[model samples]
Target: MEYRKKNSITGVLRGATFSGLLLCMAALLAGCSKDPAAGPEGGVVTVSFAAPAIGQETAVQIASAASQAQNGQSPATRAALAENTTVRVVAFTAATGNPVQANYVAEQTYYMSGGKLVPCTVDDNGSFVAVAPDAKMELERGSYDFYAITPALPLGSDKATVSVAHKVDYAASATKGVTVDASKTYTLTQLDRKCVRVTFVIKKSANFTELTALSVTPSGAGLSMPNLPAAQSVKMGADIPAAAGSETLTVPASAFTNTDATTATAATVLLPRSAADILLTCDLTYTTATGSSRQTSFSSTAKNLALEKGKHYTFTLTIYPFDVSFTVKAEFETTISDWTDVPAPAYPYVSEGRYIVSRDALGSSDQPLHPDWTAATMPAHNEVSAYNALSSEFEVAAEDCNSADASGVTPNPGNYQYTWANALPACAAYTQAGTSAGQWRLPTIKELETIYAKKDGLTGVGSFTSYYYWSATELSGASYGAWAVDFAHGNTDGNGKSSHNYVRCVRDI
Candidate 1:
């Protein structure tokens, strides 16, 4: 005889006649078989399972219950459930009708397809079709208990030991006693998923630029739930490693707003329900603008968290910059008021003045001041003295002073006791306003030594090469020589006037 197939088997059973209602009631009432429905020859029982009727209200209750179970507090608002992907069904038979402790009957898994439960089918060639909807299983007629779970269980040993592969698995089960009644179909509902839904919302401070990685691990007791049958306790052995099993989630850029309003959200994690509190430890790694890497960790333990089945918990974490420490060099005051006891005092010489030494050696204007100390051309003794008659405040050419041409290929020397004093005013970088036009000159040996003494304070502000710098002082008896200061060791020595050395112009204001 043909049997009538109905849509939404769960909804139909909810409004069936009193006799049909008894059969429906038998689904959840384990072992209660009063007057079994008679079946055709061979007594074959047909059973079908469907997805739970998860409405917005039911979704909210599930989320609320989950939050209260995993954390001592419940969310102010309810949350929506994620999409259902697959379903699993298991059958058990016992003379006493207690499915939880009865003998294993049969088991099959199905996946969601076109909004229906389809059993996984295998082809003749040994290839398996992973999903097929409305899968029905025929079993020998008897009073048998049935259980159905969602997101189908992973393939493993047997009903006594089943493993869940997903990071977050939503599991629901319904136990019903079915008696074959001329090809009867039973729809399963009110399955309690034995897991908690957890969503993590991570945020970073302004000082942090990129979030390299984030990891969450549940530590301490309560990692496993007692709701599972004792015979199937071995399934808990498949628990994900605490430190490992970090979700491969990408935190979107929009989640990093300055107002701490932006957040990177992780997909829901299906954690096993527990009777005790579970502590979650989270680690964050990030980068900074200065090319520095930093790490921080947070630990939150909900006191007395009795994780109930089918609940949801949300966690919001805000990461701040780590405290950093550094040292700054002290600087000497830049003012100097005395120029007394000097030889060959000139007309524009003032008793009191302020002087500034060039922080960098002359170099090509296109080069960076800090590290690029090499320049194309440098003036020597003869070129500096040739301009002595013109004006003390002469702009010195960038080429070698001893060279006859601007190309610096031909060497030429003038009077042996040459002074860069006349050429120093040309270095506009070191010259100050309201001072004698030619006052900007090469520093004396003593003045160069003073600058060397305060080198530490000028570290970042000035770029000084560890070479010799030209000084205004001439070697007392050496006609062709002048004194130069070694910036490397702060030593003064006499060198040929025509010899090329670095120049750091100085000016008094």
Candidate 2:
């Protein structure tokens, strides 16, 4: 009986020892355990993308502006990844020793929806605003290699070999030794696009009244993948015709929108990354204020242009009139830059009741100008009326200076008061707001009246005074008299050409 009691006590002691050991182990495990937010050993793998890098050649290079085309057309445009861009990601098991031994493990496709990558099966119902959690890629804690492609190309037998045809948009990325730890999110390097964006910036001169239509065809253009092995030919794909040889890309008129009176986004195209002559053929159809229809064809070749991938190119073309047909002294400037949407051109600084002042009255450094004028025998009232009825203020202003003296004589000869001849030359010589010579002219009687009417609403016009202002229109019946407007009283009357008065030069918007 005494031996049995001893055995029972020993058994109780053994049980207590086992319970204590269990408690200690439980406490130790609790201390080592960490919350998922505290960087655990394994968690969800969240993917992100880095920003794209800018090209090295960012300056604009000036080249010949001669109008000639291989196939025909012209440049400013931007191409960007679409919001709903689909991306296929192939994950490979990292090699234990050599990275070259990596083996493909799994692959999945995701789409860019609402600025975030989501699984393909997660239907957003086309709203793109479906409230869903970010895609979670559960990967074991290990190093991995990833290959990503946009528009999700079929992964054929050769994984390392990529086939890029002459497509408008394409991007690819290959990342090696991407360590995925439960500790933090893994971000993929930025995808590199295989094409360049060319934007054509069309600027209109004062002579360009309207742009009825415009189209561009880029000839001898093809795309290539330069990121491949140097020993391998950059060109691939025997099945794609565009990849075999140069192809033509046509930018329709619908892509270009006239944003303002001066400029328009002519066309934007995604050109291939091949070294070839970029020939632009541009066809323009429009009408001039001189009552002539103009159809101009401009073509130029950017020789041996090895367009860089992911770069934006801008080709600016300013409209030149062919009526005079002078040698085009101006040349085109090629600029490498980031993709940007052309801002609308600002114009019509002031809105008159009927007329718009594109810029402030011609003057010195935005100051109010008053120059006297004297012209030979002025047109008769009937003749002046007929001229006004037949032409615009811009036309009348040009004709008013027909008899301006060209003897290189000093203006305001005898006194500060300028004669009619001197006034014409003075207005013709003045330059402001980047205007060329002979662009500014004396305001007509009707124009002066409108300016006075909308004086209060002048937004960006130069300073003005409540004084008599000369008009391009001559007095109806006087031989040496012209019409003038009194801004103070809104009175209109005939005045002698020798009379000293304020002059306000203007140009067509």
Candidate 3:
């Protein structure tokens, strides 16, 4: 009988001594045993395990999962494990020629020792001994399947024991069996892992300056294997930190393909592959200029995310201001040619609708409006569209100039034609000729002064009475009085709220 060898490079000698031939024949005869529990009839097999290069995507997933598990709570931090972290390897063999139901035969922990994984043995007392690069196992002379796991914490043979918290990477090779032979040494290499890498990228807008903290939580953090029972649900989270004075958070270089100096990213996490959807929630906290703090949250779900054995997924979040308003051309035409030229008018350049105001109001101390106020020079100031005195340009309603009825009659019987309460609603209801309803309000004192200073430019366009026009700004110390602009002399003064005056409305660009 001749001994059969598999996965062995060394060949047997053609001519052997009589005694050696007899010994080989006996070993070959013993290799025919069908019982797996039977003692090895062949020579000892030295099995060495080597990890293939986990592609960038897989590496990122591992890092991301680990980061989330370790830092998912308050005061989050990065994971303790790194690229070179020690990983425990375990080997399993089929109990009855079926890889799905396997039995653990050997275990060894390895670390990246000088760029390669060096195996270590755990004694009965749990103490570890630095061993040779390979793990030796003795088995009966027969074919056997091998299943292995890395980062191998003690996850008994059950799938329920495997968790994202443990960060286990799985690999199995059943197509090629290790045939034990008494006369040869067999080696097993290339145990590739089945896992997914996840990365999170956070971006903030310039207007969101007060953002203080950010955190990400992931749902359904568990492993899904083909032969094992489905895994239970798990949640993991991580805190993401932003760079100083920047609109980005700091992420590891391994997480992104383009690592330019200007880009910031969050740490990558690794997770076991799953057939179910993975959901993530992001929470952000910010403070206002008044020292008030608030928190906002956003959610993103990867529907039916079937993470393959070796792939990467990235999630991104962008935080912006709650209120976003931009200047849009009013519905009505604003061309100067549309206005009817009148003789001996109170002001000039009045159109049928609203006027095209410069960004900076005339006589505005912030910046002077040039005679040639083009769009470039007179940029729109929508930020201060409300009542800020520092804003330069604004549109004024031509209603008051059209007629006395459009001037807004007094809502109260007192001397004041319009109180603050009365003025606000009147502006809301006021409409100009050939224009739709708009979000109009009483002009600020600065806006009134601008219209008055530019009165010479509008001398022939529209009619204006030399009287004080009410402004939205109230006297800082006097609750009973509000500021007013006297168009007659382009001067501003505080007047009693009870005192009646002309009313003109203004709206943002």
lDDT (CA) for every model shown?
A: 0.43, 0.48, 0.44
Please give, for residues 1-509, the per-residue lDDT of candidate 3 as tens digits. Answer: 13346322234344346578889889888776544334455444455444433222233334566666787743222122233434554444534533332355555565445545566654332234556545544454556554433444344454213333212333322223566455343344334434434445554545456554433323211222222223322211111111112111223233333232212345333444334444444444445566676665554333344444333444444454532111111111111112111122222223333453432111112122222222223322222332233232345666452224334534545333565556655665566655444456666566676667666555434556687778767777777888787777767888888776777776554
Regions more than 4 Å wrong, model 1: 1-42, 54-84, 94-97, 100-102, 121-129, 132-136, 154-161, 164-166, 204-262, 268-308, 320-509
Instruction: Quote each prediction's TM-score.
Output: 0.36, 0.41, 0.35
Off by over 4 Å in 3: 1-41, 55-97, 100-107, 121-135, 139-142, 155-175, 180-192, 206-280, 286-309, 323-509
TM-score-sorted candidate list, best first? 2, 1, 3
Query: Model 2: residues >4 Å from true position, as ranges?
Result: 1-82, 95-102, 121-138, 206-244, 261-274, 290-294, 323-509
lDDT (tens digit, per residue) of candidate 1 on 292-386? 66555554433334433344454444453432111111111111111111122322111222222221111011111111111212223332232
Show how many residue pairs clash in every candidate, following the order shown.
17, 20, 35
Q: Considering every candidate listed, which one attains the maximal TM-score? A: 2
lDDT of 2 by residue, 99-137 (tens): 222376666566676655565632222223233354545
| Candidate 1 root-mean-square deviation in Å | 27.2
